[model samples]
Target: MDATDGRLEAATVRARVATRENIARMNRSERAASALWPVPLAFGLAAILVARVTAVIDSRDALGIRGEFLIRDPDTALQLASVVASGMLVFLGIVFSTTLVAIQLAGSQYSPRAVRIFLRLRLTKVALGVFVATFVFAVAVLGEIRTKSGSDFTPTASLTVLVLLMVATVVTFLVFASGTARLLRIQYLVERIADEARPVFRDAFTRAQEVQADRPAPATATRVCTNRSPGVLDAVDVADLADAAAAAEGWIDVVAPVGGYVATGAPLAVVHGGGGGGGGDDRDGDQDVAIRRCFLLSNERTMLEDPAFGLRQLVDVAIRGLSPAVNDPTTAVQVIDRITDLLGGIADRPDPPEWYVDAAGTARVRMRGDTFDDLLRLGYVEIIRYGAGAPQVVRRLHAAFGSLSALGDARHHASIAAMGALLDAAVADAMPAPFSDLSGHPDPRGLG
Candidate 1:
């Protein structure tokens, strides 16, 4: 009995650790910065190795003839390599400056959260890495050129490699320029955010299906756990929460929903079955710690785990377009189209489950899951509210609802009809007598 109890305790600890690590990975800055470090380190190491190998080869008189290679004279080779290194360093500086400016522009013009899309681009990281690597390799090779016995000795292989790197640097620069230009466009930004959000929606849908099949009875609250700090509830490791709850012979109902700002001392979750031990007992304390470990709180919202974050970003863009200063109804309409595409993808899928169960067939965790109605409201209602005064905006919104209603799914139709009705009432109240007729039906072209 002692050994069995020890093994169970060890397993619980492991589960808790894994849950914490998973939460840490949801941080965008941490993930992007991690990708940046490895590039410079790997390239710096490669530079040293290439320099050493070329020096060894040069010592053995490996070059058949000095003039056979493009760079013949040792002095000229060193001079040219140094120039290339300087140019690459300057180019790298320019790239970093331009990228910073672009990030600033994106943050100011679009939603600040949209900046992560640029930060996470693999192409930009690789471009930065290639230029830095070339510069390092050129400098290393330049250091190895030597003079001995009235003869100049140059490493032909090293110079050749440097020339290739220079060519690669140029190619990468052009590609990076084009990519940066594309990133600035609103269409690309909307599509990219939507693409990233699709998987999150699918995962939530899958989990819901699993929970629905083996639905367990909700447990009555035995204890409530309060948070220690204030932040947005970004994500929760539900599986790990279930593991910990099972170990405590109980279940946890997560009180704070994802994307919600939680304050310190507020009930984050309620433990459902542990014998009323409050916070003092060792077993109860362990359960409290385990439950807290599963909740990932952050100062800002992230798309990694919050299914609604992407929709929020799209809404931000649309609302910004409709602002009085901007007065760009077409931009708002474009955003609605993208939102329509995303909603259409998940329209027919079943809603995610609110409860999580353990291997023992006991319900262990209760979470807030995404529903079609919730998504529809998040994606469209705000835009409708803000753009109600603009006929074009109102018309485009009606068209979006019509498109979704056309799907023929009863669940989707119900939400779409309700939103359309609300939009019609808003337009009637906001638009003047002359334009009230525009709200009669969804015109795909928005009064054009």
Candidate 2:
């Protein structure tokens, strides 16, 4: 049965990989967005360069600069010289930008919206502004030249060419700037929405993944594991579950594997990974059995849904579950990821017409899925029940209270006390049955 169960668990776990893969695919969209800034940047630099070279040529002739000269008037020469200098600066700026972009895209950390921000500075427009201003100033100088000599300077084909170039540069600049700004605004709005709703989505993804793993597979057998020790049931702690999850590889999400007492023979911990000989070793058959049974029993026993605990232990567990492996504790990235997942599930709960309120003054108990109850039973939840009277008490409370942003604003003990009052007396009075009562004493069972 143990072997059969392990195989079944393995197969059940296989089913979830596809969903996980899908989410991963979504991540690619994010990467594509981050990669989109270089286009505008390239155009802006090219325009700046053209304007610079024209200015430098005109400057040399007017200022008596030694370099090869073309335009005769001081003003015309200076404007052309200025354009050349500006172009060189613009070229350097682009090179620097390219390097920075390469670094950021290599890791793909920034979101698409953030990339849009980088592109929306209106650099092209700014460049156009300078060109327009310079051209207007040149026209004034041309008027002065004609007034002093009482003769008009005929506009040559070269002057006409220069004017056309300037017009083209400004127009291109505005077009690029307008497009980038519009795109950036859209991306920013999307990002804000994603941020607001991220917790809920993340939790859903993780939960769905877990369900897919636990689903039954006829090819393998399954068993329940319980902590049957006579004395205190030193069952695995929440810390252990977190530790196991954290210790696993990034792609291989670890979840509680089984439920019930070690049912004579059960696997406690299960590993979800690419089965192509790339998975971690179980160490030994005994260790594998013990770990698998422990996970099953723990998840089965724990109760994770309790409104009173929505801001407390439940949130803590949710954060821990989604958190990165303990080895990567330098950042809270994983915790944030898991929090997003937890919130998503809470938000998506179907609307309930009535809130459950028991005599204990605690919210009424609304049952969640069997998996939630099974986990609660495994000692995973200190208290498990729905917030009756308000089906979405947690969500509502968070909305009113401003979420974790001001979670500390409310009195912690006060909420706990109120919760204690809400628990149904009858259920509260019931004591947990001893492990020994369920399974006969110390026979040859090796679980202990």
Candidate 3:
């Protein structure tokens, strides 16, 4: 390539593609907290530091007769510290083995998307942190053991703290084991997934209900295209983008969906009203920088703003269960219970706002949102397609539709009725006429 083209390509590669949705948030990984090592590493560092202070404290005679402390003799104390250090290595092995097994079981029993749930547990991380911390603290305490003036000296206080930490790690391991076992259950996984999605839906609904400015699209517009790599359009910082538009005396039309993936060099947004800044001015440049800063990208879509993703996961689990290899219809029934609860809340606010405005109530960005019908279809269509033959799944879906019908929002009625019609047709396709009638009954437990 020519030198000029090479320089241009180099510049493009150096350009910032996207900004983080929130710097302080931890949903930046394949799983929560990203890696398991950071927490354990932090704990290990703290253990070394604490071991020094504890050693110094135990060296003095102030802590209620150092001789009567946990262990007194230097040789015996070293042996005990050695035991703890060695034993903790075993504990670490067990933790890793158990965690891997649990993760495998969850992935095989449920959807692969559900595997992240095990990694997201706070207790599991804490257990690992405590295990590594205890091991490091014990190793540090060994250094404090020595013989002075013919008598062996022991860091009694450090030993005592190490013992307590060892106990905590044991307790944590037991609880982690139990939590992992429970996580394998389909009901728990789907319920937790649905619970996480509810607040996202409510936030989206509340934002949509709020009034926005009635600004018009400008005759002449500057289309802001992506200058770097691609990622999921996680969250659009609307208020900030609107402020950028106002600074340039322009309005923007955001040509992206919040949860969809954007391709490289795609249109990020279109700056309308000419930014009111003269050509080649700093104000126009400032608006471009602000727009770039506002589009937060993530490695994976999170529960922060993407409401449909949760339903997508739940539907994934249900449909997989209904597959011929699994053929576990009751699992889908449990998922239907969760879906019904979410749909009930969604029915209350079926339409989310497409326009976003600045503090002064001027429209600056226009982005599209899924309609009620879209979500309903997303939540039900695949399940209906795979689960039609199962009476339990069909009954539970019918029950879900009937419950959604009671919601006050008249807008949801049409979608609910349409899905009910689709469910009935799917049932007809699955079974002969007279027997298919049996699946029409709405049973909360499907059979019960």
Assess each prediction's global lDDT (C-alpha) against the native. 0.76, 0.32, 0.75
User: Per-prediction count of colliding residue pairs?
Assistant: 0, 71, 0
Tens digit of per-residue lDDT, candidate 2, span 60-160: 43443423234545456446534644653564364346435633542233233233334333443344344443344334334322223544332232243
lDDT of 1 by residue, 206-320 (tens): 5332522233333564788888779988788877888887777776778988888889878888877765435643344767777888888877777656779889988898888
Compose the digit string of candidate 3's lDDT tens values, residues 69-93. Answer: 7567778888888999999999899
Per-model TM-score, in order, reads: 0.87, 0.27, 0.88
**Best-first order by lDDT:** 1, 3, 2
lDDT of 3 at 126: 81
TM-score of 1: 0.87
Best model per TM-score: 3
Local error of candidate 2 at residue 401 (angstroms): 5.3
Off by over 4 Å in 2: 1-37, 44-78, 84-214, 218-276, 279-448
Q: Answer with 1 or 2, whichever has the higher lDDT.
A: 1
Total backbone clashes of candidate 2, pairs 3 or more residues apart or in separate chains: 71
The numbered model that scores best in lDDT is: 1
Residue clash pairs of candidate 1: none
